[model samples]
Target: MRAASVLEADEGRLPVVASEPQSASGLATRLELLRNTLRPTPHVPLAMEGMNLFAKLEYVNPVGSIKDRAAYWILKRAAERGEIRDETTVIESSSGNFAAALAAFTRLVGLRFIPVIDPNISGAYESFLRRICPTVVKVEKRDDTGGFLKTRLQMVKHLCATTPNAYWTNQYGNLDAVEAHYELTAAEICADFESLDSVFIGVSTAGTIAGVSRRLKERYPKVRIIAVDTEGSVIFGGTPRKRHIPGVGSSIVPQLLSHAKIDDVVSIHESDTVEACRALLRTHGLFVGGSSGTAFAAIKRYASRMAVSNRPTVLFLCADRGTAYLDTVFDPAWATRLE
Candidate 1:
């Protein structure tokens, strides 16, 4: 599809160009439009007994996830550095949200997107990618740790080496992903609250917590930065096991996490993740993704141990909406299996 046609199909939501040129300058203009589309997501108060808790509504982004920030920033920075041209195909290994975000933004600039995913990707995300992306590579083979991440990364490497004009965004180790959250996500949080006592962040590629923790520490040095990981995730030195939650944790420890100054780590089981998600929907009417539920679970765990007098202000990111998880997290059958 032509860039002009794609922009039109967007229903005049993005900035328009009369003629779609495939030049570097043209790509920059399209990147600028993508950047302009990002707005500061709001933080709403979540009622707890003692703590002043708030959840950052990152699911409201253009592609409905916090990954939108990193995906756009990585692509925009790549364009500025002359790493990607109009003919370049953007490739990445993602479970769901990142791939969806990349597919959406790359289509706007007329670039082909190939997402190297695995079976763990949610049905909603897989269907979405199959519809929008030019190619979706699903690696069925699991690696030594019985996880698909290593196998997916291997496929990404193979695709990048074989395909001409292909660029791997490499979200796992990309500092641009860190910078995106540091500059945009954390900056927005800082602007919203003058003082924060604690922040809970979910770990996957580790970009979000790494960037956010560094930035928040610089602003509120005493603020506790808690890294939330799933029970099976190896990101925080846990034993590797099968994890059903798509975006909550990781099998491999992301290099980006090495840059973070984490205060503590909270590992939650998939059952707790499901419970937290259901509770958020039932109590607060917030339908959030698995990772957000994981973070919320960590928040509750942390708060329960706190002294009665310490009713500190806390914030956790609601990474994405729960519509994508209806079949898994919200299903009674699935919840029973987790138990």
Candidate 2:
């Protein structure tokens, strides 16, 4: 069932709201399109009952994470441009979510996936990918020296160079992720919501910043797109330092970030992130990952900046269940370690 009509002052320029599907194949098509059209899932915050805070539940996507959107977009775009075919094996390096998503989706479409993972990731995450992907390559995260994720990716590049047919999604630095978010997420925010005060999001490679910020600016030029980075991330001009928050806190600003005109970059502490993840689990039944926990912390901080009314403020849970983070974020001793 669809809702009633909505037209704004500059409505026609906006693309039609993406239509939902009713069947399995139809659902696949819808999800594929969703990579180019993510919608805001509305929800009310407990702290603010009368004043609703819309947290876009991105974890609902098929692959148990929002990275599924980027996967679909980049893959389809690749198909369109003759970059990949059915026989072409898919490849990428990821902490877990992106690789897991690629593995699942490649299986669904009868394609092969190669996941390049680092030793720093959780053991369970490694096991999960091994089950999904046809081939799993682990890179050393050594204290002294190891090629790690970066080195593993270079290895894949070398393999692809020699191999006859392989498709590298290259999501870490891929502009496709940025373009995917731009097409789907940012546009949805402008169309569905009216006059959003601020949006809180965790930054990884800054693709979300470029994508989400671009569309928000197109709609409400004054809309506040505060790019949230973890304590160790270089995104907020911080010195590169180690942090517990995963899927975020990169050592350098992503290449895609150059195109985005970000309003403000705020860095949050790891302690706040761990606490917020617990709060989400206890209160909302949302066991989100470290980056989402970081996002939640920023949402609280950004919410203070929002007008104390029913005005909608938005944030996102980028991936699904903290089952992946159980050993760390969900563990008491882990919290104690951070504390």
Candidate 3:
């Protein structure tokens, strides 16, 4: 009944009672530990005007952020399918969380990892990747979209083709990324909430929202799926512009986005994201990242403007911790300079 023991039990298996039967079925692989070491994040509830709110604290995952779910699952499946071996090098393009998650697990399995990122990668993220991943590729040139995303993917393709034993995780276009969230993240949400009215999720690679929406809509056909994006992001038909926030928006539309299922798409500004992050810390005692704040800000607008049933339950996926954005999102000077 001790707190530490209870937490350990939660980490080791699903949050079931000790009397319930659970088995240690498989050999403890590094990927298994990385993916399964933490329990499903808590759905912390809060009272709101038109609905009940729950923040799914995804930052508590092993490597921080919901990307851990996709990264671990992608690598594990690739290894199982004989696409990757112990000596094989894993290559992927990422701005931050996905690469960091991959670096952590690949280091555990003794595989070389190269994270192809852009020049705009944050200091905190770059330093974290450097400490964990030895070979980090920085793509300096921007593509036709005036964003480095296309350029990064081009580098990934080149590396995968030329490097021996190299495999590209291709997170942006990978169906496995969506599959991972469908099986793990969506399942966790359904397990926690029997009848979810709506879910507010950010779209970057679009895997999380696409996977979760597909699974939930399969069961609860009426569940509302709302996508949270930034002003400059082209995901929801906005014109691409200079966006300073890393986690919230993407210059190019992701292949995994499901346009039909998304009932509403809200775009929040960088200032709104900053305010929401500060407000969350001040009011809810949650120090979350920009993507989370973007979702939060969008949810506020949704709750206020959109007509809805009284007291419906809404969920927000808090993607990562504010600690990762201390140099930017949480810093007044840096945020001011960006503005």
TM-scores vs. true structure, each candidate: 0.94, 0.81, 0.88
Candidate 3 positional error at 285, Å: 0.6
Best by TM-score: 1
Give the alpha carbon lDDT tens digit for every residue of 1-339 in model 1: 253644332432333223355777678768888877899999999889888899999999999999999999999999988898888888999999999999888877778789999998888899888877657899999998888999999999999999999999999999999999999999999999999998999999999998899999999989899999999889989889888888878889899989998989999999999999999999999999999999999988888765537778989999999999999999989888873
Lowest summed lDDT across 10 adjacent residues in model 2 is found at 7-16
User: Which of the numbered candidates is closest to the native, going by highest lDDT?
Assistant: 1
Q: Any residue pairs clashing in model 2, and if so which?
A: 287-322
Per-candidate clashes come to 0, 1, 0
| CA lDDT of every candidate | 0.89, 0.68, 0.81
Compared with the true structure, what per-residue lDDT tens digits does model 2 show for residues 1-339? Answer: 344232212422321222322333433443365443334544434454324556666776666767777887777677666676655777787877778777766655445678877776777778777665546777665322222445766767876786567878877678888887888767666677777766766777667777888887888877777777887567667866666656877765567778676777678888888888898878877767888788778877776666666556554544566778888888888778773
Q: In angstroms, how far off is 25's CA in candidate 2?
A: 17
Worst 10 residues of 3 by lDDT: 18-27
Sort by lDDT, best first.
Answer: 1, 3, 2
User: What ranges in model 1 sit over 4 Å off?
Assistant: 1-21
Decide which is better by lDDT, 2 or 3. 3
Write down the TM-score for model 2: 0.81
Q: What alpha-carbon RMSD in Å does predicted model 1 have with respect to the real structure?
A: 3.5
- CA error at residue 104 for candidate 1, angstroms: 0.2
